[model samples]
Target: MKNQAYRMALLYDFYGDMLTDRQKEFYDLYYNEDLSLAEIAENYGITRQGVRDVIVRAEAVLTELEDKTGIIRRFHKMQEQFAQIADALDGICQLNEDRYQDDALEGLCAQIRSVLSDLKQE
Candidate 1:
């Protein structure tokens, strides 16, 4: 349940602007705010079932969008790749630190860092 909630939050973060205002509100209250369905219904002056229905519909829309676009999946893959690149760079820096005291190693590390910083900004 906790994992599902986290995934829902991530999905919302990625595609929430696509949701209707009411849908976004309900989703935020129910998932992000950790509100009960009854609490959301009371806040919105609706029945618990109505709140549930809206959340279910919102989840469906989010899932459909993810299935079609796969932006979130790609983003995760990119993050993993970046981590791997960073790790490789760290290993190279460590291994070459003793062998090379020149600016070449420092220049290579600086370039990698610059590239990583640019990618993260995107």
Candidate 2:
């Protein structure tokens, strides 16, 4: 999945708990299929502008849900921090002829486990 789309899908999974039928269909088509508004409009037999409006409203609802609940934001922040730490650990793993490299890698690996555990608890 595209990165933005993946984030949007997570947002949907969180916010979709509250969408109306038409709103859910619109969001699923636009984000999941990579479809253009015009294409979705054609499929639904609505005007392009009408499709655009519906999509915009749905996006707003999703955003509102995320902002209110903050689950998606927390998930994104955790992923980013985890990636950075993983990259740092990879750099440490590359160090040669150094005892500290082993220590660093072990510490980072443990930190990664901690992060995963915390997320699971959440």
Candidate 3:
């Protein structure tokens, strides 16, 4: 709705498999081809309001799926956490060369991997 590329991509990936055929057609034209609602309506032989309704409904479906299946959301959170851990590990490698920190990093990486696996499971 707000036209952020990353958010749009997440919504598309999460609900891409769940859309109806007509919804998919409208979505592809609007999202993938960057078509305006008026253009989509004209190409699909529908009114602009009809195109708007289709897109709104599709977005609702995607939001509902994301709410129900938090794999995508959790995966995003995990990615951020992983990035932080990687940065910390790099700093540790440079600043603290010791067995204790190495063990801690190993444990942290294991936990991160477990979180990634949980997200992947869904």
Candidate 4:
């Protein structure tokens, strides 16, 4: 359940600008602010059912955008590839330390690690 919410938030982050102003507002209030339908409706001077309708519309928009673009899917794939690359680099670094003790190889590994760290941060 928690993971599903996180995924929705990530999708929103990617394609939220595509939503209408009211859709964005209602979606943010419901998901980010943890507001109930009644509370959001009260604040917006609408019925709870109206608020639910807006939120549902917003979700459909977000999911549709993700389906068309698949940017989120590509991002997760890249993250997994990066982790594999980092693990391989760690093995190479350890081998250098134990067997080769080569300064040049150590420096190169450090550079690769730095680049990986920067990419992961983004």
Candidate 5:
């Protein structure tokens, strides 16, 4: 369906717990596990159309939640800000190293980079 897997995953991440257990299971199988609708239907002992309907309804729920809360939008904005901060830190470190060659400054820069790395990982 136009390769919306990434968007679907992000929506699921933000709002998946709101879904019923059955909806979550089918959504995970179809989207996260990359299973075809037919495969999911086979596994669940349902028609392919039934599996598709569940996934589609789950996706609509996720989209509605995102529209109302805007949490995912804010999250992406925060990530962009963090990336900008990391880039600025990198530039400052480069300038400090070029001008001063101070070991203490280098150590501080290393710590900052480590913190940024950890944040990005999370």
Candidate 6:
């Protein structure tokens, strides 16, 4: 259940702008704010089922966008690849410290780490 919610949140992060305003609000309330359907319904003066419908439609939109574009999927893949690169750089840095003590190599690793950090921030 938690993982499902997390995926929905990530989907929203990727494609939320495509949703209608009401759908966006209801989805955010249910997923990000952790609001129950009943609570959101009460605040919005609607039925719980109505709130659920809006959130469901928002989810459908997000999922459809992902299916069409695969942007979120690619983003996750890039993040995993970046992590692998980071780990490799860490190993190289350790080897340098223990054996080589090469200043130029260390500087190169630092540069790569900086670029990796910037990519991950996106």
Top candidate, metric TM-score:
4
In model 1, which residue pairs have backbone atoms overlapping below 3 Å?
none
**Compared with the true structure, what per-residue lDDT tens digits does model 2 show for residues 1-122?**
57777777887888886888888898888888778888999998999899888877888888888888888778878878777766775566566225565675677667776876586566
Q: What is the lDDT of candidate 5?
A: 0.92
Rank by lDDT, descending?
A: 4, 5, 1, 6, 2, 3
Query: Estimated TM-score per prediction?
Result: 0.93, 0.59, 0.69, 0.94, 0.80, 0.89
Please give the range of 10 consecutive residues that has the lowest summed lDDT in model 1.
94-103
Residues 14-116 of candidate 3 have per-residue lDDT tens digits of 7788999888878878878889999988887889999999988988888788889887888888778767766765666555455455766666666766775
**RMSD (CA, angstroms), candidate 3:** 4.7
The order by descending TM-score is 4, 1, 6, 5, 3, 2
Clashing residue pairs, backbone N/CA/C < 3 A, model 2: none
lDDT of 1 by residue, 1-122 (tens): 88898789889999999999999999999887889999999987999999999999999999999999999999999999999999998888887787776588878998998999799779
Error of 5 at 70 (Å): 1.9
Better of 2 and 3 by TM-score: 3
Tell me the spans in candidate 4 whose CA falls farther than 4 Å from its real position: none
List the RMSD of every prediction in angstroms: 1.2, 5.1, 4.7, 1.0, 2.3, 1.5
lDDT against the true structure, per candidate, is: 0.91, 0.79, 0.78, 0.94, 0.92, 0.91
Please give, for residues 1-122, the per-residue lDDT of candidate 4 as tens digits. 89989988998999999889999999999999999999999998999999999889989988998899899999999999999999999999999999999999999999999999999999
Q: Higher-lDDT candidate among 3 and 5?
A: 5
Better of 2 and 6 by lDDT: 6
Candidate 3 yields a Cα-based lDDT of: 0.78
How many residue pairs collide in each prediction?
A: 0, 0, 0, 0, 0, 0
In candidate 4, how many Å is residue 87 off? Answer: 0.6
Model 3 worst lDDT run, 10 consecutive residues: 92-101
Residue-level lDDT of model 6, residues 4-108, one tens digit each, is 988998998888999998898888888888999999999989999999988888888899999999998898899889989999999999999999999999999
Q: Is candidate 1 or candidate 6 better by TM-score?
A: 1
